[model samples]
Target chain A: MKNLHVNFCGVAFKNPLVLASGVLGVTAPSLSRVIELGAGGITTKSLWREPHPGHPNPTMFGTKEYFMNAVGLSDAGLVKGVQTMKELRERTKEPIIANIVAGNIQDFGAIAEAIAELSPDAIEVNISCPNVESEFGKPFACSRIDAAAVTKLVRANVGDIPIAIKLSPNVESIVDIAKAVVDAGADAITAINTVGPGMRWNIDLRTPILSNRVGGVSGPAIFPIAVKAVYDIHAALPNTPIIATGGVNSGRDALEIMMAGGTLVGVGTAIYYHGDATWKKFTDEMSQWLEKSEFETLSDIIGIFHKA
Target chain B: MGCCGGGCGKQNGEETLHHELNTEPRAFVIDRMWEEAENIRTFVFKGTLHAKPGQFCMLWIPECDEKPFSIARDYDGEIWLTICKVGPATTRLFEMKAGDYVGIRGAYGQGFSTALTPSPSPKGRGEHSKVVLIGGGYGTAPLHFTGKCHQDAGSDVTMIIGARHKNLLIWEKESKDSGFRTLVATNDGSAGIQGFTTHILEDLLKNEAIDLVQTCGPEKMMRAIVEMCIDQGVPCEVSVERYMKCGFGICGQCVVETGEKMCQTGPVVSAEKAMTFSDFGVFHRGAEGQRKNW
Candidate 1:
């Protein structure tokens, strides 16, 4: 059988399938459950130094095609969130990608420093979440300077831990932002943290569907957009490790993402559609395809689209 | 529909079912809309979303918010939502007419337990398998479907509906129309019993042989019913409401104290499990994941 194991940014994963942040990674038990379900690793829901009470009800909405959410990064504050991650670390040896976000650059560093103390396998700096733009203004990833600033500060604060700066697909130049952060000391990058702070309308109600009015769109409909973003980023920075998250629903989709330069495929919205076993389904299908193609590892296909 | 005895096939077992995952909201035409009670209305829509009794759907009102509503009735090819105008989303839903269009996704979440069905014979054990459904305020909506499911399954079903007053008491006539033996209670003594539904529940427990009790309503009322069911040794199931984002379970906002997400493990939970929750009656989390008094 072809080996599915992948080494991403110095951390080992049995497979390239990692649970994307914000799906079911809210609590320790939930994250652990995802690990048990066959995910190679899991990212914690974006945590903050202080508890943020996201928006009111109707924070999420979806159709058969896509899902929109503005959960506002509501989390259990730094102390509790870190404690949960530490507990998660104690229970399993799987890589934990601690996702952190902040209202400003300084707080970003502070939160990264605090979470780094727990010694996660990696620290994913969330500078591009579109849902929180209402509260914190346009995402840092939208501006190369701000994105690089946050990346630089987080890289400095986290010390030796690998840092992946997550980028937004809503920006004009994702590659510019990606390059800026990479140059600023980011060890890795997670491309496309949802696309468009889009809105859905309730025609009968004459109002917006999300309580937050608008939210970041994710799921199968945005898969093409995510693929392009990852492809572009990989072309720009061929050596940088990339975690492609968005609209990955099936094994074929994951394979496509890997071929587009994703070292690790992030599975989020598929769980909403296919149920929690989606990760296993993805990896299983990917393995079958690899064996059928006589490929021994994911590296054989990573960025295959770019070959002459 | 019999209960799975805590081992619902979907829970703690091999993942065997593949539900179609649709994120695009389907356009459902409102075939009919009528006021059920003082502030309650039932919207009958022509749609094709198959839903279990306790399962819910996210109703998307274009440009407005999407909210979860229990499948009150799914008769003929029509789905019904018995809504009370309690908030912005529902208020907008209430304003819509019969010809309006609305977006719908899912018939999501685990429905009520079917464990106590296939009715116990009256001669063999009359009181041992009777199903009692207690609904307070708008919480009575989903129970109508639960009662019908039990009745259709050949079990004796009784519905107790309570409201602040006679005007707010919902589904009493509908229950009666559907051939269910329904009891009504009003806080102002404007109807059958002049007190809370729990008071009527107490009298029923004293007089009848209720095998199981299922309830939904204000958390305080459900808590009382759960406590009563525990004291009487009757198995109970409850449908709870929370600030839900994704009706399928991703949002994590609809979690009860046991860390079980209401969207996944339940919008319906058993009395035994309900009692284990420290936040059951006292509080619930809001969109911010902070505790708010229920």
Candidate 2:
């Protein structure tokens, strides 16, 4: 019956729960359903310039700890996604964050220009896509320069709409990338994308589990990696608002992410593994745990590991 | 007849059960039971779940990897899972007592919708519209629910179920007693009609002016029946299964690309749309887009 509100990068969340990008914010109706089920906010599936054909088939694989996907930032682009945003905004009282990914520096500005018209509460820049490989191809958010370039490009044009730079877990030094985005005027940080060009093979078929041959590994398997990124980024920049992503499934996972320095936990694979009710379950369960632990507010738990 | 009869049908208690989404597994207890057949039984659970009928829930017991089973029936505060002791989870499930605690989460995947907007039934199941429900293996569960729904809505129902042998046909008596004109088939001719359920379905489709046909089971058989329905112009819905790791859309593990993620979009897809699926009844994809040959 009690309300659990928290602030993520200055935006207030009724709860510290958000539907992570790529975690089933595929359409307006589904996103609306998630909000009705009590998520704090909904992040649209990361959108791109054109409708990405993505891989042929078998785009994802899984393990007990986690799963992997190389969906190639598969999307219906911003123009089509705007309809979903319009509907979500019209129906749900929750904040809507538009996720944008581009293949080139200029593309970031173009997408920012397009999404600014949609009038979402925030924008998340995904620079961690492996699909951005060629010189002409989109670049991953692993490097400070590449990440910064995209950030500055979007920030230069997209005014007022808060921007959260999503970081890559594959990088050797995440701190550099985090700092680079911060310098580029990012409003917040969504730590860690799916890790690696992960692979799996079925012995019976003598073939790989995914059609792309590699994918970003996610699920329960990547929780530790996600937690570490949040912790490291928080330690490096104490004031930076972080949205922890990857393998978070339950209220405990959300609490751990917040404790590790993330202000809000993103539900990606968990929504796929679980369902919308899980979001409500996470908030109720985590809030109860937090209240019982004598934590005064969600802010009180942020980065507790560092103090210990 | 009401929506869920025999105390085995209910939607879910997601709206009422205020469970926090914690890592700790939630507990469930068996509230009632429906003996479908000798070994196949429908276990009605009074636990918290936000489930869709065609979607599945993972049953986890310590030291045992969780296994997925579809929701056979649903109503407020409860759901019925028709299960067979085919594997580890089911075997362990069979060992559970009425008062025993079980771990459960999710009612994952998109479910079939019968156009709740009060459209005319394709096979007007108002006690006069003839309908045929076909199921094989564990596929009988959802089809049974479909049959019950039709019967509740006043449609005359005929159900055909098949298995390897007479002993394998679960839920036979219930199908017969439920006022559904029941037909049974087995590969070994141990009982009921000899040969595949599809053959029986084909004969019925040929002979009767059946209004609607819904089916589940092995992909090949479902496809064959679906193809038959398509040829006959009888509307049909199929409950599909995927080797899922996460029932949600993110892990992308259980995607059956029918132009959308199956987990998020559907577990029950129309025969019309399912025909467009590249892997429909033939293959499923792995993480790399490789055809995971079924």
Candidate 3:
């Protein structure tokens, strides 16, 4: 039997396919549906200390290849979200990764500590969300000091559980940001979130189509950029587990990210557009191609395309 | 199509058939695409789409925004949308080829009345009624077939269209012979009247006895026309536009602030009801009734 199991941040998944957060994890019932459809694991929607109603209207827009969403991190708060996770644990056999975000370093640590008690498979500390006007905006990660401060706070408080820092690609150099997180004691990293706040104007109406005016851009358009970011981060921290995200639409996309040195793949907007079957598509199709290509395992593909 | 019943391909726990049942939302596919005017293209799609005019559909092109567009024509397992290449979604839509799968969902919002079901006449022909259809720019597409449907029902059809320039006037040749009277308006005096379509409509309402008035365009223009109809006591309907995410009622993304659900109830609403919109004629609404100036 071909072994499909892969280890992510020291935890085992039936395969490398995991449902990246956002709307995919908004409610427990939806999360259960994702697991039933065959995802190796699932990540909860990013949670914060307080409930945020999110931005003004028009937070999400869809295009042909992919979609752009700026739900403004509308989460149920750490306590409520942790409770949902506990309920999820009862029904799903798949590993659950909790995603946490905070306005400041203290909240990040506090939420990390709270989720740690629930015993999730791992924790993803999201330090970058470009679509909203939040405290962790450009100034926080534009310099090394802020990134280090937040990462250190989470590391100090989040007891022995594996901690991954989800980095932003909007900065001057992603390498500098990745280094800051690694220096702060992050065990792994999920590179890139949705890119730039974009806009759409209706010519007939002669006005901007989206109510938010701008939102985070994702899909095939950001695939190349995300891949490059993952490649660079993996090269910079060869030992750090990197979970690749952004514009991963299919199993072929998953394969490319792994070849670019991603240990696991994070799927978000694609799941919103295509639903849970996308996760199964990524795993089943990639497994078939991997076996047909005579590759023994996933690690063989990691960074294989980035040989210097 | 029958509902999935949330129970498909499951018999005795042995996988008997392998036809993949869609576990997610169905996307729109453009089977044929062509430019009908400068910056305007007609996308002919063949899919299992069930949509009606005034009911919006979300068109997704990978790497661009998923946009909400009105269904212009629906027939025989095919759908058509006459769109202006505005924003990233339409711009990318212009680059699509035949057979490219475009994500689609909808038949959302309230649609137009099916021509009053026609009262039976003693002569076996429906009694003639007077219907005036007004459209501005691409908003004209939905009204085209609607006017045709009216004409088919033995109603007198008059179509008044407005665009910024003369070149933007499309389908004039086709609509000219569809048993309807055509009136053209442009921002510049190059084509017909050198003013907004509402200016011409105001004159029409004052002189001619119109039984039904249907309008769709910019919110301000629609509001003006609706108000005029309200004052004159003409039965009026307007097709509205809003930023929609899921074309179905799920995502609450494309809602107008009538304090009513736009996706579930309408993109097409009575002029009397539209006047109650808090954001009416002032701004556009997003998924959650957030305003963007009209």
Candidate 4:
């Protein structure tokens, strides 16, 4: 098989398929399990300064087309988050990206400083989480200034550690926010958090499905949106690295986003559909797709669409 | 690509059968309700979940927290949930009367293997494998279902259900009504035996040539059962409980020391695998995935 390896934000990933934050990503065992099952790297669930009591279940649900969740960004807080990161570093050789989320710019810097101790391969600043608007009040990704403020704070605190600012699709201009974060000292970008705090309810119950009433829409339904977001971002900031997430369920989806200029692909909802086999299937499919072309590795095709 | 197993489109075959996560929770009206004890109530709903004996469904009390409950019985198309009025979800669930609707989905996770794993038992017939089931309190509900399935499979089955008192024991009548030999044990001596469910296991093992043992209850009791089954060289499967989110493998909240997600690799595990779980009887994660000693 052709090498599927790629370097994202200065960290070497065995392959482009990285486990997205929020899905099977809290503990060392969970993150390690995903890696053992074939993920090239792991992005932990958003780490917080203190334990967050996310909305209650049914926080998540999935269909063939989409996976919806309003887990409300529940996490075990920073102390436990760093400990798990340390455990993961000891357990696996796979690259680990510490995904941190905060309601304020100051807390963003605090978490960034704490994660620096474990020295994760990358720090994914999750300013785009869609479900926690009630607690955090409209994601920082909603405004270019707010997004950049969080990015600048995180960037200033983490020494030389690579910081990938995770952007949201529920924004007026994803590219503008992407560019602002990059300009604000971000080393990379994780494009597109869940698409919407969308609502789906059964008429029979007279209630919305999620306890939070609405949640971020993911799964294969958002695959095209992710591609477009990445395409638009890569078109403007061709030099900036992007960790493309949202609706990437197959190898073709991964390739489409890469060609649109994603440095690494984030996969989460697929675990609901394919379990651990999701990663191996993606890389294997990508290798077969690459074998039919001139590219020797996945990186050869990064932003290949822009070149044409 | 095909039936949307994440477009796992496994092998690019439309006919490929893969597991699809049931992400949608639909409403089902309670067809009936029976108060089994002061605290324990059994609600019957209309649905063809086709759940296996040990599998469970997430019970959603619209707008309240959703939780996993064992499918106590599925008769024709009616599924039953035996709930103990305890926390927020169950408390709200208890307030509902018949015809009330609640969101239900699942038949998720591995169930007790009625056919038994490893086809050839010492008797060489995995089918019709003689089995013993032990359940404590609400745990009795699922074991009763497992025992009923064994009976349906033409297997010799025995169900031993126990609680603090006769009032707390859930399925003695149901298990016995299903034609399986049923025994009851209670700590207060208000039921069959005047001791714990663990107290009866030794004598039962001495008498019965059992092929498999299945349990769900207090972790300490389940652990003891697993140890006894191991000593007897009988295969065993135990259903474990842990506070969870995502009610699936993607969250590690319900993961045991074996790194197995109870929502995925288990909720039901073999005796050998259960023994390997260091945190099995010691602790389970709280809602925040923080360790809470049991």
Best by lDDT: 4
lDDT of 3 by residue, A37-64 (tens): 7777888888777776665434565665
> lDDT of each prediction vs. the true structure?
0.81, 0.72, 0.72, 0.82
Residue-wise C-alpha lDDT for candidate 2, range B142-217, written one tens digit per residue? 7666666677656778989999887778767778878889999999899877899999988888777777777778
DockQ of 3: 0.03
Residue-wise C-alpha lDDT for candidate 1, range A144-184, written one tens digit per residue: 89998999899889879999999999878999999999999
State the DockQ of every prediction.
Answer: 0.28, 0.07, 0.03, 0.55
Instruction: Judging by lDDT, tell me the better candidate of 1 and 2.
Output: 1
Computed on C-alpha atoms, the DockQ of candidate 4 is 0.55
Pairs clashing within candidate 4? A24-B250, A62-B23
Name the regions of candidate 2 deviating beyond 4 angstroms: A131-138, B1-130, B133-294
Tens digits of per-residue lDDT for model 4 on A179-233?
8998999999898899987999878777888888899999888888999999999
RMSD of each: 5.4, 12.7, 14.3, 4.5
TM-score (all chains, Cα) for each model: 0.79, 0.60, 0.56, 0.94
Q: Model 4: runs farther than 4 Å from truth?
A: B1-21, B116-128
Please tell me how candidate 3 rates in CAPRI terms: incorrect
User: Per-residue alpha-carbon lDDT of model 1 for B26-71, expressed as tens digits?
Assistant: 7788899888888889999985566667878888876666778888
Q: Candidate 3 at B198: error in angstroms?
A: 46
Query: What is chain B's TM-score across the candidates, in the order shown?
Result: 0.89, 0.81, 0.83, 0.89
In model 4, the fraction of reference contacts reproduced equals: 0.64
Each prediction's total of clashing residue pairs, residues at least 3 apart in sequence or on different chains, is 28, 47, 20, 2
Top candidate when judged by DockQ against the true structure: 4
Of 2 and 3, the candidate ahead on DockQ is 2
Task: State what share of the real interface contacts each candidate retains.
Answer: 0.36, 0.09, 0.00, 0.64
